[model samples]
Target: MLIVEELHMLLLRPDGRVESAVSGNRLYGEVAAVLVDLALHGRISFSHEKHPTVDIVLTEPTGNPILDTTLQRLVPMRGKRLQSLVVSPKLDPLEVVVESLVVQGVLVRGERGFFGWGSERTPESDPAPELVLRSRLAAVLAGTGAPTQADLSLLSILQNLNAARAILRAECGDISARDLKKRIEQLTAGSPAGDAVAKAVNDAIAAAMVAIMTPVIVAATIT
Candidate 1:
């Protein structure tokens, strides 16, 4: 599964509703994940400046419709700040991810409420994928295993979304929220001696966090 799909799964309830804590910014989280996935695939890269901009390294199709479509949209957006991509009215990463999951039979699209007055719901049709994903993340968070670059990227996006605690609470067992936060920080903190790929992933994730959080911070200050 793509990191973005895993993120969407984590954000959802068994009944298909988005977790309350992340409902407001779920799209942004998914968008960030998509960008991180692209970076991991070597299809994109981020600048090292204060406000990092995204640049497409390759325009070749990724075989995945969602990524391919997003890549096409990003063609004109090269050198744009991550914030722009995250908030772009034209880009609907969440919708694309959801559709992909539905087609993969991971999620079932249904409706709820009175005749025609209801809203659509996407309940889980298959729990196996998410189950495996959570298990890997649990092992990493529990310090029982090492985290891969994808793990760090997903965790970083969840942290910035302020949904990590709620999403991982059950899997984390008795681990305190403070400790979980610390562990995530330690894992995401790139090693100066790490390989170039790891460094690039870390940079992409960090740039994504700044892009995802800057507007919220600015709005809070203004209020």
Candidate 2:
């Protein structure tokens, strides 16, 4: 599964309900996941030792359509701070990924509007995918086993966003918040990013997590 896919999955409720996945703030995290996936895939390198902030530099192409396209966008942006890529008012980064999920039968996109006045598109996920995802995460999160790439990816998102507690509580009401903290510590201990890119990725992830705590920041990122 793609990092973006799991990121979207995390925002969904177990009963096919979506909390929020199409916002600038949430998209920021989603985009960071995608970028991290690329970095992990060796399609780019990050130079974070610059005086002020971190910078992203593209490497060889991965030949994957979505990832390659993202790299193409970053090519001309040399010397640009990585933060710029995390914020894009003109595009909803999750739109294409959500549509792909809909096509895969994992989600159904529906319109919620009144007489074409204020129509908005919403996503409804299939419960099976979510159930599977939740089970894998719950097991790995609370388990003492080694985490696979997919598990690490999901856990990274959870840790960075401070979402483990909320997601676990939603999944299992009897679960304690302490369990979530333990899982985060476990997953964070195994981050695979090198020193060069680690700072950039961490900064991006931190910004996204901060946005989760502040709705005003979320609103600021929107048009």
Candidate 3:
């Protein structure tokens, strides 16, 4: 399963509904994961061509049509900042990722009608994936042992959502929030990527997501 899917499932409840709207954080964070995964798999490479710009360039066809298409889109963005490339209107990576989950069995489709006129087919995560994923994350957060690469990736997504508190409280022992925060710090500090570019890209994406979410957060607070 993709790390991003696991994160989505975690935010999903047993009743087949997401706890929050499809926020910018979740949307862009998943896109960032796909980009980073492709980079780690050697399908792409990231470099700074000029000041304050990290460009993603495809190295080879990844064989996955969606990823390959995204790679093609990146080719023209040779020297653009990663943030700009992420928000490019030409692509909606979140739709691609969520559709993949729906195409798989992890999420199921249902219909909903609003205002008595409009209906939409929405998908929500299956409980099974979230159950297993949450258990695994809970164990790791409790310091049961060292985390695997997948675990590290999961940490990145959940962290970006600022869902650590909910995750720790719901999935694990009666640990303090501080402890949960510390454990996440420990895990990310030891993220097994071993590639500086991947780490930098991940950090940049997380930062960008934070910026994207901040306005939404404030508007919600004010309302």
Question: What lDDT would each prediction earn against the true structure?
Answer: 0.78, 0.61, 0.62
Compute each candidate's TM-score over C-alphas.
0.84, 0.73, 0.75
TM-score ranking, high to low: 1, 3, 2
- Model 3 CA deviation exceeding 4 Å by range: 21-24, 48-59, 87-91, 113-126, 195-198, 213-223
Error of 1 at 190 (Å): 4.9
Query: What are the per-residue Cα lDDT tens digits for candidate 3 across 87-157?
Result: 56554454555566778767766665565454334455555776677778777887776676667766655
Backbone clashes in each candidate structure, one number apiece?
0, 0, 0
Candidate with the larger TM-score of 2 and 3: 3
Per-residue accuracy of model 2 over 104-206 as CA lDDT, tens digit each: 7887766556675543454555667767777777666656355666666666555566565665565434667676666565566666634344446656667
TM-score of decoy 3: 0.75
> Considering only N, C-alpha and C atoms within 3 Å, which residue pairs clash in candidate 1?
none
- lDDT by residue (44-111, candidate 1, tens digit) is 98776655788889999989988998888888989987766776656658778889999999999878
Q: What local lDDT does model 1 show for residue 208?
A: 57
Give residue 52's lDDT in candidate 2 (0 to 100). 24
* Poorest lDDT segment (10 consecutive residues) of candidate 1: 191-200
List the candidate 1 regions with Cα displacement exceeding 4 Å. 112-119, 190-223
Best by TM-score: 1
